[model samples]
Each structure stands twice: as C-alpha cells, then as structure tokens.
Target: MSWSVDNTADRQVECDSVAKQVRSWNWIVGGQYRLVDMMGKGSFANVYSAVNITDEADLVAVKISHEGCEDTLVAEAKVYEKLFGLKGVPRARIYVKERRCGALVMDLLGPSLGNLKDYCGHFSLKTVFMLADQMISRLASLHSRGYIHGDLKEDNFILGRQETIDERTVYLVDFGLAKTFLLTNGEHIAPKTGLNPCGTLRYTSLNCTLGNEISRRDDLESLGYLLIYLHRGDLPWILAESVVGGDEKRRLMADIKLHTPVKKLCEGLPDEFFAYITYCRSLRFDEQPDYARLRLLCEVAMRRLDYEIDGIFDWTIRLRDDLEWKRLLALEDVF
Candidate 1:
C-alpha cells in the first residue's frame, strides 16, 4: 500500500482502525515489560509504551512481534546483537517467549525528526544544519562499524534526552533493515545485481531503487532528502493528488525522484544541499563515504545561514519533557 493516499476519509478510517487495534493490545510481553499503552504499530510488530515494574523510573519501548511474524523480530534482534554499544544507536535487548515470539526492549526516545518537523511545520536553517551534522555523524559512525542503516529515513532519527546532560542528542533507532555492507576483513562486500530497493522508496536513492546494493551513499542520500524536507516542509515530488492509481502513482514518484535535477531541488536552499546530492550521486556502490567531508559541509552551511551549531532546535525547546514522562507513567492498563 502507498503512503501517498489522497482520500482523506479513507486514510482517516484506516488510521482509526489501526489505532483501535493498537489500543486493544494490552498483553504484557513475556510476563514482563507490561504493555502500558500503544506507542506505534508497523506492518510486522507493535511497539508499546512500557515500563519494567522493577525499574519504573526508566521508561522503555517494547516491540512485540505478531504471532506469525517472529522471524523479523528475531532478525532485528540479531542486528541489535551486532549494534550493541555502538555510538548513536539506542540500547536494545532482545527477549524470546513461548512459540518463538520475540520482544525488543530499548531506550524510550523523544520525537523523531519527522515528528519534530510536523510539530514545527518546518525547521529553521540552523536546526536543519544541526540535524544534518548529527545525522551524518550517526550514519558515519554506524557505517564505520561495518553496518549500513539500510532503512535510513526521517522517522528513524529520533531526539534523545533534552533535559539531562545529553541534550539535543539524536539517536538512530530500528535496525530491522540494517545489513553488514563491509566484511570483518575490512573490505567492501561484493555487489549483487537485480536487488529491489531496500528502504523507504521515496527518500531512497535512485541507484538503490534501480537494483543496486545498499551502500553508505544511499544512507547519506536519504539523510540529504530528510534535511531538504525539514527545511522546505515538503519534497519537490510529494503531490499526492497529482496522479491516479497506486502502482502508477508510485512509479511516477520514483520517476520524478530519478529525474528531478538536484540543482532545482536545492534551488532556494543552501548550496551545501546541492553539494551533498552531487557527492552522494558520484559515489560508487563499494566506495567508502567521506563522512568527515559531509559533516564539514553541514558545518559550513550553518555558517552560511548565520547560525551556530550550538543553538537549540525546535524539539530541544520541548513542549513539555515532564509531560511526556508523566504520560508514559499514567497510560491506561492494557495488559
């Protein structure tokens, strides 16, 4: 199903149905991590706003797999095994229950970049620069550890700890699609042909959509699109009403993405944005990405925007941090 649904009524009904189903799920996962309430539900699993009764002070998100969907949860757990202690990644622990079902316990994070963007309508140039700097660094850090965030998107980069010492820290989450792009021998993995796009198609790189192996550049390019969205409030090709038919609509969106001139896309934004696109586009699938250079470009963009990296973004100026903490605690019992 396409995310670009144009019928407001249908969309609302679909969302409501999903929300009701999510709200109805009150099962305590594995007799622990009591599912306090729903957080979000995806195709394969449901995430709950949960807390360990033994450690109530620290809230957590518990992702429980659907009965028959254990494999994905297991796969994600395996990825987390490789991702533990990695910088910028949220701390995750895996648990298995009866029937081979699984659950993932991880840090309770704040609004995602997508959530923040929706709240603010659009981000300031300074905020975009800061996000770019942090996201590029996060992707670089993950890539250096030999894994590529195969599903890099605005939603996966979430805000962390606005109240404590680690304020404005962005944490990358959801490693269910990550892949080891580099081998332990410090060599790039051999490329394969005819692979389908592995991430969110809209923000996914053109090469990725055309059956290319996932790479560091694809992650960076996805970040580049997210920065543009945060700045402009929309991508150039997101006119949901511009076409008819789901399959046709998806193809058109992909075609626009493949054909849109990077210069045109970044016309009103900073030249650094265009530079990001050019750099990522020029990279070969097996090439190592120069994350330092990308991060430096973002730093320069901040200078060009008459802002510093130290300033607070919209999310940093929280709606109410304690309100969130209280909400988690006060959530109605579903389990």
Candidate 2:
C-alpha cells in the first residue's frame, strides 16, 4: 500500500492508544529502585522517575519496555554497556527482565534541546557554536566505539541538571536505534539500500530518506540539520509536514534537502556552518570523519565572532534570570 499522511497520523494515534492502555505501576525494580512519576513515554517504552529504596536521596530514570517489546530495551541496554564511561554518555545502573518487560535504570538528566529551544524561541549564534563543538565531540565518541546513533534529533540530546559541574555538558541519550557500523572482524560494513528510514523525518539525513543504510556520515548529517534548526527555529522542508501523502511528503523533503544549497540553508549564519554541512555530505560510507576538523570549525566561528568559548549558554542565562525572578517574588511576598 502507498504511504499516506493517514499512515503517520495512525501511527501517532496507535502510540497514544498503547500508552493509555499501559497501566502505570509504582512497583519496585531490582529491589532497590521504586518507580514514581512517569517522566516520558515512547512508542515502545515508558520512562519514569525512580528513587533508590535504600537511599531516598538517590534519583534515577527507569525505562520500562512495553510487554512484548523487551528486546528493544535489551538492545538499548547493550548499547549503553558498550558506551559506558564515555563522556556525554549516560551511565546505566541496571538492566532486568521481569514478567516479559525489560527495565533499564540510568542517570536522570535535565530538559532536552527541544524543550530549551522552545523556551528561548531560537538559540543565539554563540550558543549554537558552543553546542556544535560539544555535540560533534559526543558523536565522535559514539562513532569511535563502533556505534552510530541511528536516531539523531534535538530530543535525544539533553543537558545536565542545573548548578552541577556537568550542567553545561550536553549528553546524548536514547540509543534504542543504535547499531554498529563495523563487522565483528573490525571491517566496515558494506553499504546497502532498500532499508527502512531509521530516524525522525524532520531531522533525518538525505541518505536516510533515500532508504540507504545508516552510517556515521548519516548521523553527522542529521546533526548538521539539527544544529541549523536549533538556530533558525525551523527548516525549509518543515512545510512538507502539511503535504497530504506520507510518501510524497518524504520525497518532497528529500528533494528540498538535496537541492537546497548549503549557502541558502546556512543563510545569516557564519561560513563555518556551511562548511560543516558540506563536509558531512562529502564523507564516504566507510570513511572515518575528521572529528577534530568539525570541532575546529565551531571554534573558528567563535573566534571570528569574538565570542568567548565560555560554556555559559543561552539556557544558563535564562536559568539565572529565572532564579532571580523567583527570589524577587519571594521578597515581595514577605513585604
């Protein structure tokens, strides 16, 4: 059957229906963590705020797979195990399968880039560059571990809690779709076509939209699109969402992404932005990306703008102002 807009709508409704059908339980997991309020929900799992039973002060995020979807959570746990101890990667505490459902406990993180962007309208150039450097580094780390984050979107990258040493750090999460790009013998996997698209339509790479096998380059390309969207508040192909047929919308977006000149997409931004996208598009399926060079482009942009590469992001400033506003409100109340 030809894909239509109804297909996408039906999928969303199905997810919501599934979420509503899944009963929430305050059950204890691993005899240490107790599930509390749900933090988020996805197609296959629900994430809840859990507390360590023995240490009430210890908080974590528990991701519990829906019944019959245990393998998805199990696969994600394996990816986290491979990524353990890597900077910008969350640490997994435990993984358990009980009653046909898998649960994974990990560090609780702050709001996602998507939420922050919504709060601030659009990020400043300085903030974008700051994020670009760190985000590129995070992807490089994942790639070095022989894995590619098949899904790269603003929601997958989150910040650390406020006032902490890692507050400014951008951590990549949600490895449910992660896969190795290398074979067991350390050889690069051969590229293939006719695969299903693996990421969010809005932020997926052109190659991904074409149904090509996802690789490190696809991840980087998706990141480029994400960075641009964060700064510009939208992309040209965003309008494609309103198109009627799902297949037609996808093709339209692919054409827009393919034909849109980097100069036009990076309009009003520094030349480095263009360079970043161009370089990502130029990489071969098996070739290793120049991680250092991509990072250097961001650094160079910072220098050109005379902006200090100090980690104080737009959200940091917003947080400070919010705190001060609350303090003044308290003072007014006392008066």
Candidate 3:
C-alpha cells in the first residue's frame, strides 16, 4: 500500500505464474496477407509483418486471433472500422473482412514504444510530459466518440519515421481489446459487461482494475503510469521476488485483481511532475485531464531540463520527428 519496491522472492513467483497462465491460451500464427516476420507477441495475440496480395508493393501489419479471445478481437475490428482514419489514433486499414482467420490489417508503422524504450533506457521528464500531452489529446478524441482504449502500454504505442526525413512521431495502436462505452444521446444506455480486466498490471489504474468501469480517466491513469515508467524504467512496485514461484505470482495477480492499490512507483522525481502523475492517477470515472493544465505542465518540465537536456528541449511545439528520437536514444546509449 505504501508503494515500496518488491523483494526478489516475490518477483520470481509472479513471473512464473504469468508464464503458466500463458501456456493455456491458443496462439494463431497466420494471416490473410503473406506473413513475413513477427513484429511482436503478447499474452494474447501476435503481430506480424505482411504484404497484401491485392497490392504486392504495399505492406501491412496483421494482428491474428488467439484462443479465448476471438470475440474481443472481432469487437476491436469493429471499433477500428468505425474509427478508422480518425485523427489522434492509428487508422485500421483493414478490419476482419475474412472472419475465419480473424485477422485485422493496419498500416505497418515502425517500431513500437517498447523498441524505443529498449534503445533509450528511460526518458527525461520533459519528454515524458510531452508524450503525456499527446496521449491525453488522443484520449479526449476517443472519449468524445464513447470508446475506451482498454489496453494502453508501451507495446501498444507506435513510433515511426517520415519517409522524406527520419522524423519520429508517436502513434497509438492495438485496439483489439478496446471497449465501447455504452451510451445514447450523451446518456448511459446500458451497463456493458463480459470484457476482461485486461492491460498490463503495473500501468492499469485502481478504478479500472477493480470497478469494471471504463472512461477517459482510465486512459489518463494509464498515461500517468506510462510517464512514470518512461522516467523511472521500473514499475511503481518491486516485483523481482514475485517472479520466482507460481503461488506467489497468483497471489500478486489476485492482489492486483482485488484492486489493492500500488504506491506511486515514481518516487524521487521532481515535485511538479510527480504531482501531475498523481493528478492523472486520481481522476474519477467522469473526470478527465485538462488540456490547458497539461500544456502548462509540459512547459514547466521543459524549463526544468534547460541545462543537461536543453539541446533536445523544444517546448513550443509537439515533437514530430526522429532528430529528437536519435538524440534521446544516443543519450541512453552513452549514459
């Protein structure tokens, strides 16, 4: 409850348990397009690089279905179709047109945030704040249409370089588990049910992990965790010990499932940034982050990094290219 790091034994148990659970699910490996190479693999699905037969020169990323998750995949495909090419979110180029394999195709964006994280250990406070602003803006757009990005994590966020110039920009993707907020005429139409409490445990918020409620605030909470992780390179709590044994892993998962709140894993950060994270975490079901407030926070963070990281600092506009990306990664490589 106090948000201290976990001991080694606890972490081992948690890891082992997660591994066992993953063994039971069915993972599919093919797609309608010619699968070239695996992009990434998660607990439930696998993303692959493929080439479309209809247009051989064009490339696509196909997400295939797995066992115990066909319905969720279908629902996600529908959401993508409805929200395709909408600003702020990745456009799904193709939905599950061939339902038999349950594959959805989308623009083959470059490496994900996970790849960037591997290249750049943890980001500076300024970079994280900027990313938070972008994520919040995207969330605002989604909430306006009554949808919730149930899964928001590093793997789901994509970063790509422009063709003419290597400018790295962020793009949110992976909606296979996204949820639709059941509403009608701006009022609740019915209570939605049957969706799993899915999402990486560390980044998920207290309300979402427990209450089964989805809202724009839920996305904000996740964004807070994303910022914290980007700055800290660790989850709020220590789990190294839990990864050792199966029983301990289950206990950890159960603790998470029961909504046993973890402390702000972002200790020792600057007060202003930490306060922003706390604000994001505390948002209620109906609450949302204020864009103007977020912009101010970004400005404050940019000022704080005016010395050591000043070379990469540009608070006036959003980051839309790979110069910043290369600089950030270079810092990580050397540091």
Candidate of highest TM-score: 2
Root mean square deviation (Cα) for candidate 3: 8.7
The residue-by-residue lDDT of candidate 2 on 109-132, one tens digit each, is 888898899888899999999999
By the lDDT metric, which is better: model 1 or model 2?
Answer: 2
TM-score against native, each model: 0.84, 0.93, 0.71
TM-score computed on alpha carbons, candidate 2: 0.93
Residue pairs clashing in model 2 are: none
Residue-wise C-alpha lDDT for candidate 3, range 271-311, written one tens digit per residue: 66566656766665566457568656766766776633332
Candidate 1 lDDT by residue in tens digits, 117-165:
7777788888888888888888887887788887877788888755665
- Please give the ranking of all candidate structures by lDDT, highest first, separated by commas: 2, 1, 3
Error of 2 at 301 (Å): 0.3
lDDT, residue 275, candidate 2? 94
Please provide the root mean square deviation of candidate 2 (C-alpha atoms, Å).
Answer: 2.5
Q: How close is candidate 3 to the true structure, as a TM-score?
A: 0.71
Worst 10 residues of 3 by lDDT: 309-318
Ranked by lDDT, the better of candidates 1 and 3 is 1
